[model samples]
Target: MTADCKGTVRNLDRNEAAGASLQASGQRDQVISFRIEHTDEHGDVTGYSQVELRGEVIYGGLTDGDRVEISGRKGGDGILRPSRAKNLSTDSEIWVSNRPGVKILQGIITVIMLLAFLTAAFFMITGISGGRFP
Candidate 1:
């Protein structure tokens, strides 16, 4: 399960610390030192936090010592592969593509409804024409 963490950046990579670099994927990936307060399931502070993370999207212009909130799953390599992040200082939502495309589903449903309506209309029109006038 992924956990939400809020903290300040402690250390950042020298490359991204200075400026964001366009990567081969065309998405700017930057590593940030996040000082988040870890907690257990019982809501107790664990006194441990992820020292470093590569989660911030480049649009927020994250840098060293910037406050941020990130959410990710802890991997077997002891690294937090965050999927979403936001800059606390600027309150900007950086990454959120994990949940979208509902429009396609809705479009499918709409087509079904339209087909049903058209079938009913066809029956009504044919029945009215064939039946004797009252």
Candidate 2:
């Protein structure tokens, strides 16, 4: 499931920090940060918040003071992952894509672990049948 929110860009410091780390580690990644401003039924500001997005900024060039509407899903880690963002100030939009290779590697590792467990179970069963149990 996903949710939507509207807010202004508080800072792009996360991107800068991530960029520096990526440079040092020879990795490619970026984090987008937003300060979500909550509103009441009367269209008045009620609260403020912050969210981080793990993906590349594909367009529209987000910056401070840009009003944006973001639609995204909250990951299992309790981080809000943006799927798309529209910069109302620039009248432009940006789409986000999480790195696919990481997910693929996770699936592969899970399968390997399952197979290893099954192999161990099979050997144990065979050993018991051969009078090597108890």
Candidate 3:
């Protein structure tokens, strides 16, 4: 659909990382929360209920209940034909995993300390052999 499909933004079921793969060669649908109301002929609210939008939703933002637009071709699935989707908000929190970097730095420091201890032992052994001790 070329038209801008407006829907409330909601959180995804998965914990995603920053810059992670969001789209793949498959049908994707997202869940959104919104209020649904039925009006009578006199324009009076007859009924209302909370609704969840489940269709081909693209990863838009990180917050729940954020408005978004989905644009793209729908696969064979019965959901909306979303070729691409973008979040309406620019301010979204992206999470990144940095434990690997911390682990690497710790390993380097450990190796350096081991090397320093070995060098000091070598010097002490040589000095004792050369009768340099008082």
TM-score of each: 0.43, 0.54, 0.31
The models' CA-based lDDT, in order, is 0.60, 0.69, 0.46
Ranking by TM-score: 2, 1, 3
Model 3: residue 21 alpha-carbon error in angstroms: 23
lDDT of 1 by residue, 8-125 (tens): 6654553343456654334554554545655577867666456444433333456666667777787775566665678788777655232224546767888999999998899787
Question: Rank order by lDDT, top first?
Answer: 2, 1, 3
The model with the greater lDDT, 2 or 3, is 2
Give the Å shift of residue 30 in candidate 3. 23
How badly does each model clash, as a count of residue pairs? Answer: 0, 0, 6
Q: lDDT value for candidate 1?
A: 0.60
Mind giving the per-residue lDDT tens digits that candidate 2 earns over 35-59?
7677787878887656676553344
Question: Any idea what lDDT model 2 has?
Answer: 0.69
How big is the positional error of residue 98 in model 2, measured in Å on the Cα after superposition?
Answer: 4.7
Every model: Cα RMSD to truth? 11.1, 9.6, 12.4
* Alpha-carbon deviation at 22 in model 1, angstroms: 13
| Location of the lowest summed lDDT over 10 successive residues in candidate 2 | 16-25
Q: Which stretches of candidate 1 lie above 4 Å from their native place? A: 14-48, 51-57, 96-134
